[model samples]
Target chain A: AQTVTQSQPEMSVQEAETVTLSCTYDTSESNYYLFWYKQPPSRQMILVIRQEAYKQQNATENRFSVNFQKAAKSFSLKISDSQLGDTAMYFCAFSASGTYKYIFGTGTRLKVLA
Target chain B: DTAVSQTPKYLVTQMGNDKSIKCEQNLGHDTMYWYKQDSKKFLKIMFSYNNKELIINETVPNRFSPKSPDKAHLNLHINSLELGDSAVYFCASSPRGGANVLTFGAGSRLTVL
Candidate 1:
């Protein structure tokens, strides 16, 4: 069974600083995709970033980026210049090719302190 | 316009009662999915439908049935709901072949008393 793991249960960072949330997965399939989602107090799930296993280059979206290490089965998300609006619960998800099902990890509560 | 929409965002019902939640996506996507988020924030895939065809049905209980009348809509009907059924259910959709990126709707929170 493919599983995504987020070791940190809670984390906080000061505004304007950078924070990295760690994620690791165990999967036998070589072809897969990884994602990071954010859920705020409004209870809406928002896609922050995505990474493909075949691509060696990490994925970046504005202030959000991912350090995807396929060999180590790790995909960590980094939020640069964090703001109070960036505070939310972060989730790591994994989806293997041909399997439409997405396995999600227990979320990490992230708080940005001003 | 909302890309994806779900009705009855908040539902509170007694145990043993039956309820239904409806979802519709206007993204012209061919695939739709249902996910359940527990109190601990663990998401579990419950079902998947592609163009009104049932493709993936996880180990959900028989009391839960998903119906896709068209490619754009998927509805979940639960019979004899239990206390454990209290959670937020999300409806999501993605384009065919680009299944990795999903557009999710505002979830429906079900509270079984």
Candidate 2:
């Protein structure tokens, strides 16, 4: 079974600053995908960024980027120029190349102070 | 247009009662899923359907039943709800069977008193 782990239970960042949320996973499958999702107080799950295991280059979306180390099985999300609206519960998820199930991490609550 | 939508954004029901959460997706996607977010904020997959076919059924209890009327709608029904069943349920959709990016709906908060 594949499991995603988010070490940081909580994180805080000032407005316009940068913060990184650490994530690691245990999986034997080589073909898979990783994703970072944010859930605000509204409780809507939003996709922040995603990385494919086969791709050596990391994935970046606007102010969000992921440092994906396949060998280390680590996928970290970095949020730059953080804003108050960025405060949310962030989760790391994993899914095999042809699997319909997605395993999610425990989640990290991020607070962006103004 | 809303890609994925769930009805009764907030559900408050008594214990042992039966309740249902409805979900629909207009993205014309072939796959849909249900996930539960516990009070501790741990998200876990409960069920997945592809074109009205059951694909993945996690370790969820038998009291929880998922019904897919069509390719675009997947509904979750809970029989004899318990306090432990209180959590936020999210419905999501993907274009294909697997490994595709998911589009999630604003969750339905279910509280079993």
Give one digit per residue, the lDDT tens place, for model 1 in A1-114: 998999999999999999999999999998888999999988889999989899999999999999998889999999999999999999999988777788899999999999
Worst 10-residue lDDT window for candidate 1 chain B reads B94-103
The second chain of candidate 1 has a TM-score of 0.97
Local lDDT at A96 for model 1: 86
lDDT of each: 0.93, 0.94
Instruction: Give the per-residue lDDT digits (tens) of candidate 2, residues B1-113.
Output: 88899998999999999999999999999999999999999888999999999999989999999999999999999999999999999999998744789999999999999
Clashing pairs for model 2 are none
**Each candidate's clash count:** 0, 0
Query: DockQ numbers for every candidate?
Result: 0.58, 0.80
Candidate 2 wrong stretches, greater than 4 Å: none
What is the C-alpha lDDT profile of model 2 across A52-113, one tens digit per residue? Answer: 99999999999999999999999999999999999999999999988898889999999999
In terms of lDDT, model 2 sits at 0.94
